[model samples]
Target: MKFYSPLKNTICGVLTAGLLAVPLSFSAVPSPAAEADASSLIGAAIGGIAAHAQLNAVLRKYNDTDEGRQEYFQEMKKQLGVNEDYALNHQLDRIMTNLTAGIGAVDPSIYKKPYHYFINNDKSFNAFCTLGHNLSVNTGLYQTLTNEDEIAVVLAHELGHGQKDHPAKGARRSLNMQILGAATGTQAGAVMAAVINNRNITKPMEREADALAFDYITHTDYNPGATAAVWQRVLDLSKSQPSSFQQFLSDHPADSDRRDTYVRRLTQYSGGHVTNSDGIVKVNTKVFTTPAAVGGMSSKERSYFVMGNLAAAYHNGQNKQEVTVDGNTVRMGNQPIMTCVSGDEPADTLAQRLRQIK
Candidate 1:
């Protein structure tokens, strides 16, 4: 029930031992090494029993019933202070509403246990859906991502986790593993160690959530390209400010992989005009742009950004606008697609090329 502050920090704490603590008791002194080993084993057995019991009680109290779930939510709010700013709350509400409807469209069973969510005061780029469909979004996520579509991508991903009941299922798995480890005696605390290291959320679960997010976003009015854009932004930010995102990046899949996955998925919604392979942007089966390192992003990283812009333009009908050159910028209507640099073709030339190809 207890965890660290912020969301990711709290999850890391729980993953480590905040919630799954297996206290180890040791004798002051043992005359013989054999006796010492026996005493240690005994202590592990006792600790394992206590940890198992505690986890079971947690499941019953928090995941078993609606009343228990509501009680846990109150406790969570108290632990992580809620953000009461009217504007922020309203923004979160609007985003959540859209995401909820989108999720319901994909799987109406989501309505069975309607989500309860609030913005937490924590300034970390993270959000979580815990037991009982209770959700919390970090204020930092809002502060970092101003785009509503990008925000929907994140919330939708968390909703995916909730739809599959990952939190409760993960907890149950942890409990079973704890009991198994205790029974084995040789691998005491192995499961706890793994979870503490942030390995509890397996890669498969993350992939599934990501896939679900893609589906959810497509169903909503939000631009689906933002799914790839968000990860591309994260990858770019991680380069200059790695420490700022460690807490988030630690548990999720690699940012580049995520970007690429969503980038490839972009074709599904883009009508195949826009597609990316490894970060190379292709429009209408032709290389639209292969962006080089501009700003702090690598060539590949920058390409995803270009791909996102192209996907957005196509998604929102901006692609119908005339491709024009204004200074070094290429624009479709008022939307700035990308800037031409020294190594690249002239903006006017590129704009004309895009017009022909687009």
Candidate 2:
């Protein structure tokens, strides 16, 4: 008998190991345990084969174009990193189940497809909806929020994006390369993954989402003001950390104008409502503090301070008033200190205004 080579024997052993590791794939019909066991291994093998076959089909479609080939392969590599695809899918399914129930309470047709969530371990405060019914939220964001209202704001924002079909628009853009036959199998995978992984909230889109979120929460017990508060917190959070804003700013560029937009929308939705007596409003101005600074005073605090100063001015009834600061006397305006900080003015003039106020 001819002597067998060790390399060949090793190859055979490796192949056997792979065969054992294969998982079964099944159709609509359920399988018996014995059949299931065999099917699992065969299924895994078949799945891999099927994946490759699909990849090849995409590659062939894009083979004539270099750009297409590049895009295709990139998309392929992204989908292959499934450590626990099944578990993730199941968890996502459950989240959708709950979301569906929640949304159904408001509008049963709010979402056409079950919304999916992806927990990215990134420190950035970002969340986005993607093609094929996926929504990704950064772990950093989830940790930052104190209540369900904040979470609801973020989720509803993404849902708004989904409802508006932003993801589908992105998908169409990616497939534009396919028209040129420039995408490869690998590039296609990359494009798909990118299409999946990208969680950007554009400014207009962000505004739209904010509006939708306001609508979403107002119908429920959740405070609509939390929507504005979340953005305000994001703004303050960005100033000190800078990094936290990276993802948020990327998706939804935070212009002062955008902040104003949110404030305006919230105000309109609430019919210019100021008080949160219902306990539904969960405003955490502390959440808006910069990391370097101590927790900044809340909007409410600033408002109260102004109101108190005005009241004191009225009580004194002076045209110009002087109040004791750290040591020196600070001057108030003839009109209840029209501005917060006093500008240059003669001590006599300031005193004159204080006397007039009363």
Candidate 3:
């Protein structure tokens, strides 16, 4: 079923009538002052009830069945236009396939209501999974993230929301809170819009999704380190262009916090060899390379990512293999650790250092 906003005039009229009746219902009380207080309480109670009913009605349309979900998906796609690019769609499809397989390996019940997803034409670096496991990716995400693992990290985060039904839970929680506030413009339509657009997800829920994304990535062939790298990349980008990332940062946890969370998690695989001191990546209580800014990455931001790669190498047992140098690139087994840039040490020297340290 489709949901539409109630007309402003109709809502205003009902609210006005309710307010007008408040005093009359309490008029029989002996004290005028007591009547006035009672009226105020009754008016607030009535407003809350009205808003709650309207919001619940909107939430009820979010059905879990396949047919009901397809109906909702069609309605949403009409507003969020579909991307016509076959290549982009194919890329998203391949990523989703890999991610779903990973999720299935972790928990198979999520497949009971198979996901429906598509790439939207919206040119924003954001994606959301709404009710019924219906997901959408903005085309602008590709503009920012070219790496498959980075993109997979994003899609996996949304899948975590779907797995836990965060969208609907967050929506209900938001609507109820707004209803209790019942301030001007705290209408059901406004709350529902924010909920569907994914603005209402709480910080705690964001953290949960981040952790789940890391878990899902570890289950797949994708580098689990990308979870930290993606946030570090965002933190680096925001340093240069703060306004571009303000909206996302405001809604989610601090990028530094997210980067650190994943980085700390990644250290679990290193058997205590890898550690992060402040924002710097360290090895065995010794100072490793202090990465300089490369491209958009700041010195500290890049360090976390380098730490992530080192952690992933350990996790994959690549650390057990020979450390090789191919021109500017340093590799542990098949895993590339770092490519010596203009400001960094020579590749062969770095490889020898890795042999000593790792």
Candidate 4:
């Protein structure tokens, strides 16, 4: 439920004089070799049949029931302070609608049960998904995203976690933590304590999720490049701040290497096709049509009606102009203007005028 970084305290040293800071001494730093050795030992200790049995026992405690899922959701909600109803319905609805449309089609089964969305309202850009289609997105992330594609990248990554059954594996991990806590001394206890208190398991699970998500979205209209783009944006946003003390960086733990991983993955999937290039994936904006009416007489339709209206308004040196369609009126100016009436405008006429106006 509450995921945390395993090396959080070590990498970012303890608070001193009310300020969180990293210790400067290289001697205090754990060498990469030492960290790898600890990981191997832990992996071996938890690899045998005994560990599997313990994990199965813990997993059996909660599985395949509304009660079990409800308990899990409650725990996460408490930890994240998420509004369950709104998250499960509203935000998820928007995400599902966009993803389903973007992908062109999706398996109907994926939509049978409503998905959940969790936002921590923190300024850090981090997102993850759990079992049962539960997703968490940070508010700090929303601020950085320029469009829906960036958000899609985050959601698709989390969806990868659910598709790969990461939560079920997480149950086994919880068991491993319990065993390590009981068997080893205080250092192990500290590790287990961190695990129980939101320690991020750096044990290849998140990487697997990233890879799986990369694969999944490649089959859809969502550009795989958006994955690398979002991270690059986050990286740039971090440099603008005083320090990279944000939770997004802490929990997700991204670096230049990870960004390169996404780029490599995109290249591999695209087969030399650039993602954002015109020849690769072209968005068919013509697919979208204005609705019949907006508050009456197609006010929304007039928002994109004709180039004469646009040219008149533009050449008149007016910053804004009011347009009325029946009782409904909308202000228009710099935006390319068009109007919709009962009949459709001829494509050639509209195209010629649009070119002249431009």
Candidate 2 global lDDT: 0.44
lDDT of 4 by residue, 1-358 (tens): 2443332343123212111121121112232352345654454354323434533543343334455555555565666665335643465567656664443343344554445656754556566665445666766565566455557767776766665556656645654565453323223224334433434434376677667655555555454555665565555556676254364455454655555677656544434321222111211212222324333223221222221233233434432343323222222444333344345444344434333323
| lDDT for each residue of candidate 1 in 138-165, tens digit (9 for 90 to 100) | 8888756776778889989888988987
How does model 3 fare in lDDT?
Answer: 0.72
- Provide the clashing-pair count of each candidate structure: 2, 53, 0, 8
Residue-level lDDT tens digits of model 3 in 1-358: 0111222233234434443343322122232342346555565567666655554544455547676578768766776788879888888889888988889998897779788998877676888787778888888888778778889999999899889888778767765665564433244445445444445577888889998898888888787767877887787677777777776577788888888788778888666678877656677776667776777556765666677678778877899999999888889899888777878778888788788888
Q: Please, what is the whole-model Cα lDDT of each candidate in the order they appear?
A: 0.72, 0.44, 0.72, 0.46
lDDT preference between candidates 2 and 3, better one: 3
Per-model TM against the reference = 0.70, 0.46, 0.76, 0.52
Can you rank all candidates by TM-score, best first? 3, 1, 4, 2
Model 3 / residue 155 / CA error / Å: 1.8
How would the candidate models be sorted by lDDT, starting from the highest? Answer: 1, 3, 4, 2
Listed per candidate, the RMSD to the true structure in angstroms reads: 6.6, 18.5, 6.1, 13.8
Q: After aligning candidate 1 to the native by TM-score, how far in Å is the CA of 189 from where it should be?
A: 9.4
Lowest-scoring 10 consecutive residues by lDDT in candidate 3?
Answer: 1-10
TM-score, model 3 to reference:
0.76
Q: Candidate 3: where is the Cα deviation over 4 Å?
A: 1-63, 178-199, 276-280, 288-305, 326-329, 339-343
